[model samples]
Target: MNQYPDPHQGEPWQQPSGGNPGWGLPPEPHTGGQLEPYGNPTGGYQPAGMGGMPEPTEPTLDTIGDIAITQNTVITPSGRFPIRGTVWTTTDMSRTEQSTPVWAIIVAILFIWTCLLSLLFLLVKDTKTTGHIQVTVQGGGHYHATQIMVSNSAYVQHVQQQVNYARSLAA
Candidate 1:
């Protein structure tokens, strides 16, 4: 039996005109007005300028105020921690405290009164301050906490004042 010829075997395929059919015909010859790139006819989304995106700015620490308080020792089952000082900022209240062992303090006071042994304070891990004040923005459900490092009672009071000021501003 003879095989039937393929429908498209000899017909010449026509080439598509210059413009893409999906994107419509080429834009009309540029008039006096500016011509946008091929795809975007309206020229709505222009190429970014020389600077590209603006550089992100760093967050600034705003010092609202300070406070003064008596030095105290915090006793824990592990040991006693001394509060050397405190500081409060718009962000958080930080305490400068000592986490020296009682034995070490006694040895330093008695045998090493020259205070040279106090240098060992750097080795003590918990001696660093670890406190933060978290404030929730009114109506926004957003919360921000500032970690306290070296601050005094005045700083804590200042933070309270800042919180009140923020609340008043929100109102």
Candidate 2:
């Protein structure tokens, strides 16, 4: 037992320089047994050596497309959970166009009508000579002149009804 070196001196088991051939310290106290095999044999309380290892999980599929549109919304109040997502795709070339409103179209029609009425008022006189009327009677005879008066009045009434209908639709 006196031939072995001290364990605290970092020396392996060896015979003293000139001692007997097969002599060494028998064993030490406080080391349980030999100190060579010191790590946990049960994998540090893990089942079947699963310590320091991640669990195995199933594989997931990735989505792809030629054209895609994506929108995301989030709730900002408390007690709401977080959301994470992604969209994968290629190119997109779509758009939406605006149209003129019905009221604007009606106003345009009324403005045009006012311009035409002003032009007509400036060009035509309110009264004419009876000779001009007699020439009109000679040009178309009596029956055709009466028919023209009736049709002209009917067309004016029809135009008035159409204008009223358009105004109602605008409202």
**Candidate 1 minimal-lDDT segment of 10 residues:** 67-76
Top candidate on TM-score is: 1
What TM-score, to 2 decimals, does candidate 1 have?
A: 0.26
Model 2 lDDT-worst window of ten:
131-140
- Residue by residue across 32-140, what tens digits does model 2's lDDT show? 5444444767433222213646423323121111111112111111111111232111121222334555555555566766565433333332322111110001111
Report how far residue 102 has shifted in candidate 2, in Å.
1.2
Q: What do the candidate models score in CA lDDT, each in turn?
A: 0.41, 0.29
In model 2, the clashing pairs are: none
Candidate 1 clashes: the total is 9
For model 1, the local distance difference test gives: 0.41
Would you estimate the TM-scores of all the predictions? 0.26, 0.16
Candidate 2 — which residues are off by over 4 angstroms? 1-87, 90-94, 116-171
- Candidate 1 C-alpha error for residue 80, in Å: 43
Give RMSD to native, each candidate.
21.1, 40.1
